[model samples]
Target: MASVQRRLSALLFGVALAGTTLAGTASAHVRYVVDDPADVGSIVSFVASTLAVPAHAAIVGGSALATATGLLAFRRVRPFQRDRDVFADAMADYRDLLPWLLRLAIGIPLVGAGFSGYYFTPLLESDARLLFIGLGFLLLFGLATRLVAAVGLLLYLAGVAVDAVLLLQFEYVGGFLALVLVGSGRPSADDVLERVASDDDSTYARVDPVHALATRFRERVAPAEPYAPVAIRLSLAGAFVYLGLVEKLLNPGYALAVVAKYDLTAIVPVAPELWVVGAALAEIAVGVVLAVGLYTRAAAGLSLVLFTLTLFGLPDDPVLAHLSLFGLASALVITGAGPFSVDELLRTRSASPEDPDA
Candidate 1:
């Protein structure tokens, strides 16, 4: 058991800290490290010009047609329908992993921020690295999970109060809240201790620490578990929208700087100004889709694709800072839109009127 704990600790540290710290050029915490351009065209002008480009207009129309056709095919075809059901069922089977994933989503970024010399946002310098690191490792260990998450949230809120730049990493709010709602998951020390405490036959049962208190704490918050997905989705959506609108659209100069720095226009064969505008529009659209829970899995899958493309295309972007977004997206793919979502309402309406079970 001691050796197993050691291995887990080692693995967590290696992935959360060592791997990220070793990457020299990676520094994207909302592109904070990117230098601003001396001057740039207005976002409105860029958008207007892109709309005037015949090739760009054709590509947009073609994409919309393809998406609509694909959706229709999935609905009409037996194999496609069967595959969708099978994939959803597979995802549902692993619902127990949600908490652990949320923990990692919140924890890894905290550890990364601490090690990377930031205070939740790369824009804000950090002086409490050990505090963040300690809270992070505790969450990863799944010990005092709820308490740790709550503390993390409080610290983040305090940081936001100090510097609004923390808002750029606002997705952390959803992750921490979700962890508070769901608590620790399987393969965690908390789960192991709880099991031990429940089993009278086990030698360590009587001395199991924290399990009883943790149980009472979790039970108190059990009623809100259904909203976990809501919190995560909304938070992620907000971050995407904020990044697109406030960061890119309103601050086109810096965004255009990013485009030119990475030479994104060369890869896409579009004007550099159009690249900034197009990205802003795409991100806003993604956020809106996620917020509504319309084709949620598809949106999340696209989010993963977007994150991957960004990581590969812009080599300087911090892989660690974006790890939380990846975890959240993966969680959504697993959980979908839980309650209070358009998907839930649609599902209910689609159920058979005479025999809903069927």
Candidate 2:
């Protein structure tokens, strides 16, 4: 297990280094062209001219390397190893692909869009807008969960609806908020187990010191369980649902308009439509897989890849989003789907006779 982790870490570090190099280049070129009337256009041109090539190439190379290394690692590690080791290996496998993904998807576009939208629009500076957007999402997320508990089922739907509308207006910030709202609150596995033990006096007294110590060690060293997977899936679902609706209504040609305005056709050589469709499809697929608890580890792996790619493509400013997504993806990759997931349900049902797996 240690060996597998080391190999995975090495691969991920290489990918990250590549992504950072690309991101650095993108950042250097993405200066604010104040002469252009359309701020968005200038930003896009900068991205297309400076950032896109190296970032895209890095992604292609990283993907191949990750795949090859992963195959080699899988062959060496037996499947039915220690449960903790199995979980760790699975997580490492998922995380190894993330750096490249972030470089491609969220990070690159976000830098272009965020700088244009935040700096050129109203009174908000780019950094301030980013903070406000994050804060709004946090507040919305907290409010939505609170509403679900306070107002009951119908109200929960209404709350989600309201939140969705707000998110549509905001885009990435909205998505982030929806994720926070859906996934913000959850006790750690240790907390849950501790609570259970405390409530059951017999269990608490019966837990030997040696057993307790071992369990603590395991908990510290082992990969996370499936809880975060469920949260991320829910968050993705909310974000996509909101984004799909907004894209249809507000700016049906928003992507194209941005592309044409920037003269990206000559610079980037990739159609805006293609990029839009690809990104949308990726997000929708990620949301569906996560929500249904199907191929959760793979879904997480894909998400990590997507985010890592974004990190590379975007400018260096508003570094928080890049860092947050990176950390979140890493966590999901390590933890997988938690105890409440369909994966867990299936495992339980297969092991027992009474319960039907969902």
Candidate 3:
């Protein structure tokens, strides 16, 4: 389901319009930049045509078969368990960085959106540039992080209500909610203030106004902190699914336009239909695997690869727009699946003495 997430730069008029035009060229979304791109005929027809090609069908089938075989082999052999456990331990030790990682993921995009003259997404121009920039800086600094994240989330929700396009980056909602639950990690203003406030005789504690509210907020929300990964995973998976299923498969014209405009088939030397359908299917598969928490870290790795490939594959794709996805994927590689995940279930089941084979 990884089909979507557009750029934040679009033009209006005058000098600013010119700036928008220039900025938009850096955007990766062909639909936004192209005038009227070719549709990939009908989705069904295009898919059938691709599959009808014996070579294409064999390629797709072989890939799926290989993937299935690999998964089964990994389960049965469980090779490199010691090294894997070491890597897992290493990842666990860095859990404190999770809050900062989330902030970087969501905050950088908000700032990019502000500077690009669009709202939360490229679907609409924004008037609140300074506001978004300000909030982004605050989140980046880890200053009043929870409050800023809350504000960011509220503003995003409001925008979504009006246009529904903001849903394209719905992961921001999860990121914000997770921030509110997790608070700022070490070395942040919030963390320092909390420490100072906890000290009854600290001189700085008397002037720290946010410390009490932060403490109270933490006490109330701390219980839900474990679900942060759940929110992020589901939100990201939904975004990917929408992008793959709706933006690419249903509205194939924009993608086909991009393919033709860029002559992408020349790069890979494949039918454009195969390229589009292949990408859509890859995205959907990644999203489903991620949603189910199967090899969570591995899924994140694939996400990183896909995002990077899109950036390089489409020379004009906006680098800024993909920053959030990149950040989120990196964070997931660190955090893995939280509660309410198959990863958790498997871990619990594997711990049972009666299930020694597991």
Candidate No. with top lDDT:
1
lDDT of 1 by residue, 1-358 (tens): 4554355335323422321221111113335548656375665776667667887777666666776787577534534455577788888898998988888877888898888888877778988999989888988999888889889888887987787767777777778878888888876888877877889888788787766777777776666676677777776677677667777777788877887777788888877766776777677777766777767777788888888988888886767877888888888888887665677776777752211101
Using lDDT, rank the candidates from best to worst.
1, 3, 2
Shift in Å, residue 209, candidate 1: 7.1
Query: lDDT per residue, candidate 2, 1-358, as tens digits?
Result: 5664455345433422322221111110112211122234443453344335665546545655775677467534524346545565665665533323322223333334354454212222345446334333333233232222222223223433544322221223212322322322332223344455555466764673433653554454243222323443444444443333233112224544444545545655654544443333445444544555544555566766755654454433344423434444444455455444665666565543221111
Candidate 2 wrongly placed segments (more than 4 Å):
1-229, 240-250, 257-271, 349-358
RMSD of 1: 9.4
Cα lDDT tens digits for candidate 3, 174-213: 6786787788787687777677788989988888776777
Question: Which is the winner by lDDT between candidate 1 and candidate 2?
Answer: 1
- Which model, 1 or 2, shows the larger TM-score? 1
In model 1, where do residues sit more than 4 Å from their true spots? 1-30, 41-79, 199-212, 352-358
The per-model lDDT (C-alpha) reads 0.71, 0.39, 0.70
Backbone steric clashes in candidate 1, count: 1
Worst 10 residues of 1 by lDDT: 18-27
lDDT at position 207, candidate 2:
70
